[model samples]
Target: MTVAVTGIGVACGLGHGKTAFRKGLYEAPDIFSCLTREGRGPAEGEPPFIGVEMPEPSEVLAPRLARTASFSGRVALSVLQEAWQDGGLDDIDPERIGLVVGGSNLMSREQALAARDYSARLAYVPPRHAHMFLDTDICGLCASTFKIRGFAYSLGAASASGAVALIQAREAIRSGRVDVCIALGALQDLSAYDLHAMRSLGAMGSMRFSEQPGQACRPMDAARDGFIYGEACAALVLCRQDLAAAGKTYGRIAGVGLAVDGARGPEPNSAGQVRAAMTALVEAGLSASDIDYVNGHATGTPAGDDAECETYRTLGLEEARINATKSILGHGLSAAGAIETAAVFIQMKEGLLHPTRNLEKPLDSRFNWVRSEPAVHDIRRALKLSFGFGGMDAALVLEAPDSGGHTS
Candidate 1:
């Protein structure tokens, strides 16, 4: 029951598709731009927050779907298109394909805009608003466009929604419910109110580097403040290893772990993170010494980064080379997990690990940190971590496609 990643597609500030994403990831990591009032940035009267916004994808939806679809839904469709074609899923039976969309309240910004625009003309609000407000709208749009009929649904686990969706999609295939599944990290599309709330809660970065947007997202750095918002949507196509086409597989999901603290809040729990990491290791039949690299869940926050560092130390994984993808891509909130997973696979294939941008000073110097520039390394096994608000933590162990082994 080995679940292999057959295809991946991404739309982020870096660019669209794997080629652009790969080039930007290594060569031009500092692409953060000022958040525009009209774009995916802060609205008027809100504190200035800098972040990365995705370039428009080449794929455009039909005029009919475009009129009613939310921005998040439209972006997701474009991303999914790449994965679908890459996976060669066009030949697969539509009834055997399933989809799992991560993140809830994905259309918050769209809904907020609609509310403000139609406040005085409530009666003239578009009828599509009825379905557009629901997070499942993304699942529906993707399913219809891609012809996935086995099953499709949306799941929310705070910021870990993407990783959790990946786990669920893996399970769907392992359980024989579907021959292939798509795990999509839907764009958060945070509204002005959402940004204000996150900043008020001290979970988001301040305006310290508002003028220097590139330095705003400093994950795992001593000078880091908080996570910067980014606009990104990524999709991964998972299927049974036997179903994967020759030379098309990216890697195999050797193991997965999910843990939740009993309490609810934004704070990180070292114990829960350790539990998740250890569980994933045990599931993968791997020990601390076997892990070569770690895709850390460092969100440029004080509490979050420290907790993750302690978790690695406690797990005796200090020797693993680790880097923060958020430093280069900014935090995609719900989309972080999938994008980072894709990054890990790309690095594994390319034999080079992308650098942690803005990491001038290491938060903790004990661990092996890939700082400032890309490093040449042949990664055989890599661990990816994702933690969300409300005590959600997830870990995944990915094995190189050429790695010979199978997990039950």
Candidate 2:
């Protein structure tokens, strides 16, 4: 059972919707800024929060739902609505459509703020906190707003949550469980505690380029410190290939792979990455040489980037034009995978690859790296890789809509 991506919706620092995102990617790519908003900003004496923050979504929900919906819920509804309408899903039976939201503890910032505000007077705390704290709340909010009756749930795999959700949704469609599915990468609303913890753990970037926020996230660069945080949420509508609307399909989900490293921790394993990539290739009935581009999971972390480079070398994919979407958008945590996947589909359709921002010096000179500036290329097939804490790794093979693949 082949699956086709019929529509995509994105909300990120780059912008909202497809047009704005496309312009931000290829035209004006520099958008990182300091997080200066209340509650989200850094505390006194703390280092500035340097990363991309998404613009407020334009979609306005019903007053009743809006009153209780958290930040993640609002953003998820905005993106999902775009995807649903773009995919022309209204014509399909609501019972045949399912929803899968990615990420866990999505409302950490909301919960933290609520706890702080209500600590002085617990009696005044909003009753909505009971449901808003759970990650599944976003699922319910979106399902109800869109009336998705087939089945809906949330999946959490750290940073790989988005890709994992996408894989699960594909399987649901393949198994004849649903005719269409919406895989959404919910925005991970990190609280100050989460930021402090990551910085303390040495996984988040330091203040080396604090004055120049745009240069803080430099994936695959020798001066890279660690992954920077970004706020983003993206949604993709996938349907059975045969049922995909004509002229609406962006690409085909040819194959998908998910694997876990035996050991636990934040360290990435090249061997596990190799297994995932190889599995995806084999399932796609493709060899290494067939891949024209790779949307690498280069989070700007020193060890993570090196491991991915080695994985590419082992897979004989050095010739594939590769770039790190994180360099431009920063790391969206659980939202990274879906956001980057949307980038791949956009580049494939546009026949152009966006540049890796701030990649002044390449870590590995042997590989083909799109550095500094966007490049014009016709990508027929591409591979997207994502790795998370707890040794989770995921890979997906996407074919252009006109590639004469199963979707065609």
- Compare the candidates by lDDT and give the number of the best one: 2
Over 4 Å off, model 1:
37-46
Cα lDDT computed for each candidate against the true fold: 0.89, 0.90
lDDT of 2 by residue, 326-384 (tens): 88888999999999999999999999999998888999899999998899999999999
Model 1 lDDT on a 0 to 1 scale:
0.89
Provide C-alpha RMSD values for all models, in order: 1.4, 1.3
Model 1 over residues 253-348: C-alpha lDDT tens digits?
A: 998999998758899999999888888888999987899999998999989998888998998888889998888888999999999999999999
What TM-score, computed on C-alpha atoms, does each candidate reach? 0.97, 0.98
Show pairs that collide, candidate 1: none
